[model samples]
Target chain A: MSMGSEKKAKRVRIAPFITILFFLIMGIVGIMTGEVRRVLEQAVQVCLSCIGIG
Target chain B: MEIVRKWIQTIMALLVNGSWSFPFTRTIYQGPLKVVCSPGLNCYSCPASTTYCPIGSLQQLMAGIRIAIENGQNFFGLYVVGTMGVLGGVFGRLICGWACPFGLIQELLHKIPSRKFSIPQKLNYIKYGFLLFFVFLLPLTVVDKFGYGELWFCKYVCPAGTLEAGLPMLMLQPALGQTIGLVFFNKLAILVGFILWSILASRPFCRTTCPLGAFYALFKKLKLVKLRHIEENCTRCEACHSVCPMGVKFNESPENAECISCLKCMDKACKFDAITLEIAGLPMGSRAGARIHRPKQGEVSM
Candidate 1:
């Protein structure tokens, strides 16, 4: 097998597992800490016009 | 499809920031929808911006977490980080191709008649530095006496902030011009420099300095949506590599972070249909058929 194909197969095998693991950890932490509410509050308010538009 | 995606993304950007009647509105959109993160790097400070820029929100969360830690309060920026990870995991840099207004702007600038140039592959890592220092580190560590961390990336580097918010804000309210100091001009200069660079090299900023792009790029390997290469069918023709605007050698690394999933190197460039789009490993777009033409014996496929 060529180098590209070999690498592609290896990555495909590992990637999905890593992605799922990351999301699982993050979800647990966010729920436990109430960080979701904090993020929502920050998202709602526009800050001082630093970039000039808002 | 890329063009259609671009138009849809541009309209989404405009519509999301659709509070035009309040052009001089200093207050941000404080609606229920604001809790959702925008996929693109649209500036939250823009008068019309209803949802928050993920990068900005990430920085805010980082800074806040740092301050909370200092104050001995329990705080962690899990939500912003989690949302970003989910988006990045699902789409990778496809967001750059289909959603970002700034990415659209860079592409439009690149389309102007000019001599095109390519950046060194090594330079791609600079965006990570911006994410680490400007967006996260500096904002968390570099606090004033009042214990307030400045939004370094938004203030100093993000051209999207300047174009979407700063310039328009200045134009709308001339009285605020006096407050425009070294920081504003410095950002404006960076924005102008990026504009020139984009005209010369497609997505110069996206490739070299966009922290948001860097953040999403980390998930390129695990992304649900991806570009796939079928080794059996490839003629080793470099058409895909040659046509790639980001200069990714996709034949070798179909899921490289630098690939924005523009699909230019797929059906258009590959006559043999060697390359394809894939969602969760399911094949998409046109399928591979017979080789366009057999290569003569001993001719190099690479």
Candidate 2:
């Protein structure tokens, strides 16, 4: 593959990088602001009820 | 007969409970005498399960509202998935092959009578996308009214969760049934879909849905535990391909991250033992080292 093609592949892989960055930010905000943590808790409870599995 | 022995052992371990159950059964079996039992996905959350499952634990942690406390310390119970991943990067998804309850479930599902099928090749990569979006990103980003993260796949798509925890919980604690809603039906649909797909294929969960498998796949090439192919001896006969349930082209890379390290092709085929587990440190290639193992006479693949 040409250098340009290789660069394109690397660029495509950028999605993963963005994804990882997003999660890291969320995790930090969750741990620091506690807002994210609270959201996570409510989500889990809602899911439990939704699935009807307790 | 060997399969029967494995079944007996698994049942006994489950009934006995305690540490004798599950994965410990796996560890003991791997102690020297290898004994594999149970051919389906059976996470520790299953009423039948005796050991704690990492996937189930991860889901529970993500979904858990209240964590129990013991001995003056708060314990998230089974929130060991993150630890598993940290350590997995060390030995990797060997757990998928040996210890994972769900992986076992999929294997057993292959035994059901049906016309096996493999999804379109290019479409298979959709799993990595699932891993990223459903397993990781969504869970991390999508919060609830309260603030804790959501285990997106477990809450939304995991059949293992539905079967292992949902069905059994509802059956054992029928009161739980009254709470059922549209989400219940949605998960039920997903559970049924995967079960139907498994009957037609081998491990639909492992191939396209398992986040744990996805995590391990990332470390597959780097981990010393790998399927090695002595390429110099390879004849390119593609014997391993026919035997592989995951539909991986083994010879393309001896150790592809997609592999569960089930060793089915190597044990049954590979007349020359050309494809074998090599402990020596070898960097993973872009893909994997393709291995073509010839199955022995009278050996039937799932």
Candidate 3:
């Protein structure tokens, strides 16, 4: 492969870890900010919209 | 390998929907597990689902965004997005291939031994529209007198929700049947339509309509676990295309967005070992790699 193509391959290989890291940090922040509680509150109840009753 | 995949699909389905006490209690599971999101499109309102459906929770958050802002609270659904992102970054559509109960249902429906058909390639773009409009734009923009938006996708579309939650809940609490109106019928019609389409075409919803699948497809090129095609080993036999349930031509484009990394091509079809499963640039295994010790003919008398 040429230098440019090799560099592009390296970026492709590294992109997932970067994406994973960013999301993992966001997820941890969300948990600390009570987003889990929000999801729980909504999910625990029978969502009328989901059942098409809304 | 196919049997193993089927077993995994069955086990994951049961594991996520593990709240088996619903029949006796006549209610959905309301446990702490609901805080976590399942990787697939299983409905949180499903009687036995112990985990939240990411798409449903996302729409709920988007719908409540204005209310949250008015109350001086920031609610971007970071947790839900992050969870989905992490899964997508790691597995891409592998979850759809191996873990999603809805995807499994479609596969089973397609196996009913009828005339199978291929989905139009143009239709694949529709899921992106669903993701953008129903999941994000509508839920965030269209509001009622209370400044609260509606869960447009869940209320109007989402055949998985109808099949997993609506039909079962109605069956369980027949009294709730009276509340059913045009919206319910509309959703039921969509569910029925998708069901018949799934029978005729492999994973029609996944290919053409699932918002979750669209979200994950964004990570196809970046996912850690994926199928890689070695061009040097390929004989251009076109066998992979024939076996792909999602109709992905792996040898030609291993990183195709429609690929679910189910490994059907790698495990069953590729004769020259052109395809291999990779995790973080390392080869996990390949079909030819596994057949190196096969017993020769007439040499199996142990």
Candidate that beats the other on TM-score, 1 or 2, i.e. the better one: 1
Per-residue lDDT tens digits for candidate 2, residues B1-302, read 23543464455445422333323322211121111112223444344443334443444454443322222323332224333444354446655666555566666777898877886666556668777787556655566665456666666777876876678656665676777877778899988888788888877778777776776777665554556675544566777888777787888866676776666666655555456564433323222344444555554434
Which sequence of candidate numbers ranks them by TM-score, best first?
3, 1, 2
> For model 1 chain A, where is the 10-residue window of minimal lDDT?
A45-54
Q: What RMSD value applies to candidate 2?
A: 11.0
CAPRI verdict (incorrect, acceptable, medium, high) for model 3: medium
lDDT of each: 0.77, 0.54, 0.88
lDDT of each residue in B1-302, candidate 1, tens digit only? 56677787788778668666555455456666676678888887776777778788777766676577677655566666777788888888988887888888998999999998899999999999999999888988887776777778887788988988787667666777887777888888999999999999989989999998999998887888888887766777787888888889988887789988887888557776678787766666543463554455544454
Query: Per-residue lDDT for B71-180 in model 3, tens only?
Result: 87678889999999999999999999999999999999998989989988889999999999999999999999999898888999999999999999998999888899
Residues A1-54, candidate 1, lDDT per residue (tens digit)? 588765654454456557856976886687577666676677666454346322
**Best candidate, TM-score:** 3
DockQ, per model, reads 0.38, 0.07, 0.53
Error of 2 at B222 (Å): 1.3
Better structure of 2 and 3 per TM-score: 3
- Measured with C-alpha atoms, the lDDT of residue B43 in candidate 1 is 87
In candidate 2, how many Å is residue A51 off? 4.8
Positional deviation of residue B120's Cα in model 3 after best superposition, in angstroms:
0.9
lDDT of 3 at B256: 91
